[model samples]
Target: MTNPPYGTAPGGQWPPAGSPFTSPAAGPVSSQKQSRGPVIVSLIVAVLAIAVAIGAWFRTAHSDVTTQSTTAPQQFTTQQTSDANKALCDSYHKMFRSVNGAGGQTSDDPVLQQVYAINIRLATHVASDFMYDKLRENPAGSPQLASDLRDLANAYNEVLMAQLADAPKTELDPLYSNIDSADAKLVEACK
Candidate 1:
């Protein structure tokens, strides 16, 4: 007998390329399709794993941003100009009390010295206010007064500059001299 050309030889067991093979234990052709079920399940599991990873990344990023925003430091500022004024007034009273309590000793002691130093600063502060008011009230009232105000301002700046750290007392002597000069000029302008 001649074998069919498309499927398999009639006397032999080898199957043709187009013929489907069957296993002895498998019941039907549909059972082979069930083998692909595990592959589908693996694909589904991989996709779910990727989704969980993406969700975790977003949660961590959001938490990090929230912590950073909440932990920012706040700025500190004095509420009013009156605070500086009050500090100035209190400093003056403190100096007065210290000097008055010093029975017989000169004010060249450390406590009194600090008081003197800070008083000069206070004087400079008051003079600044006076000079500003003077300039604002009379822009071109008197040349001599204007010159005196300028001198006063320069002298105050010099004195304040002398109080800097690492500056020698000899350096500050000029500032004191300048202050005296300004005081004399102011007195002359008044007269």
Candidate 2:
């Protein structure tokens, strides 16, 4: 009346003493093999999904780096040019103020008038011979005109500052009228 091993069937008979279903003691001798179909398929799918994710990550990262590198250089160059142009504008403004004065007219003082005239001539020469020439040769974004203007402005500031300290009107006599003519020519060129 005792069962064969694991459990008795409804008819009170066990499958068999040596069968895998018949007893928990069965190990290597078991007849059934575990199914590996779903596990293998899952492993393959997981590997492919990971590969796709890695590839996508790398592609996007590379494109982003390339785009940033391309634009970075242009931004740097533009910023440098802008800074240089700003300096040029400042120098021009300073020179213009010194020559034209705060009163909106050239001074009546003979010495001051002569000084302004010389500065006007030097600035005119630079604007016409140097700046305009460079502008014509190199187009709108050229740095040459800005550089020359800054240089000429610096020179005028230095010389005029020295003259304002005590230098007589006659000290500038050598440059008189020649500068005026040059300025006149520059004005004409503008037209």
Candidate 3:
């Protein structure tokens, strides 16, 4: 038997003429609006959010343990300050005494060099510990006093090193003079 002929959809047309959606083959490409603008924006936002989270995590992970403060700790007691100054002086005296007491163990001239090296090392360490770190530990300590102490300690150390190096007498004389001047200032400040 013969099949019935295909019939028009309506109004004698092959298919419905007017519809909201159209086949891609039947419509112009420009007529189809691209939805990529919003998608691109969403992707960028997600990437930025991930980056910020990673940065925040690293900041918290590797951070040092310290309090955030704009103010220094309370000052030392008057008696405490005096005692600390005395301790500073006493420590230096002890160091000198020990170095001097080690004399006569050897007649080799190199022994003096070794002793001088030890003195420089010891003096540098002590100065850093007492003059710098000690004052820093007490942040509320007098800044001018700290400055004087640091200068004095450094001046004393420079003279010792110059002497060890056997610098010319004129250079040695200036270094000694600087030590004496720094010492006078430190003494006044400590008092």
Candidate 4:
């Protein structure tokens, strides 16, 4: 006798007809093959991106070195040195004239006199610095002038500090003498 739902096949097999467990007379089923073209293209694109980044870095580094190598120190001619010296002397003379002019004269009021003195000292300091810079650019041309300007600047600084501290006249005398000596040397060097 046969079962009701799970009945025997025509040849009395266990499974029913047309089920997957029943193999066909031909053979087993075959699956489709996958392609590797897309994967290979992706790998090539990634390698190309890395190469481009490395090339750009090298190019930037080379350009920086080239730019740094091109710059050279300046060489001053005799005429240029003379012109620089004249300019320094002219600037010093202008500052000297301004300091001795009417605007720098002492007023009757003590406070006004103090202000004038401070202004004169500041002007002298600035002029000295300017002349020093000019000499520094071509120190070989006028070393003596450079030395004198340095001394003058130092003396004036001492005098300014003394005046600020209300030092006695005796204390200021030496500083003033030093300034005068440096000034005379500068004049001679300029000539």
The whole-model lDDT of each prediction reads 0.50, 0.45, 0.54, 0.61
lDDT of 3 at 30: 61
Give the TM-score comparing model 1 with the true structure, all chains together.
0.39
Q: 2 or 3, which is superior by TM-score? A: 3
Instruction: Report the poorest 10 consecutive residues by lDDT, candidate 4.
Output: 60-69
lDDT of 1 by residue, 1-191 (tens): 57576766666555433346754343354545445545654665566557656754653232332243256533424443334334333333443344334423447555555444445544454454444444433432344454556566667666666674547889888877986787676555444
Task: List residue ranges in candidate 2 displaced over 4 A.
Answer: 1-83, 90-99, 103-143, 173-191
Candidate 4 lDDT score at position 55: 49
Ten-residue region with minimum lDDT total, candidate 1: 60-69
**Ranking by lDDT, best first?**
4, 3, 1, 2
- Give the per-residue lDDT of model 2 (tens digit) for 6-70: 56666754555666565555445656887765565566556655765675465423233224334
Among all candidates shown, the one with the greatest lDDT: 4
lDDT of 3 at 27: 60
Each candidate: RMSD: 31.4, 31.7, 24.3, 29.5
Model 4's alpha-carbon lDDT is 0.61
Write down the TM-score for model 3.
0.40
Per-prediction TM-score, please? 0.39, 0.26, 0.40, 0.51
Error of 3 at 91 (Å): 7.2
Number of colliding residue pairs in model 2: 0
Model 3, span 107-139: residue lDDT tens = 355545554455454544345344444444444
Best by TM-score: 4
- The residue-level lDDT of candidate 1 at 22 comes to 50
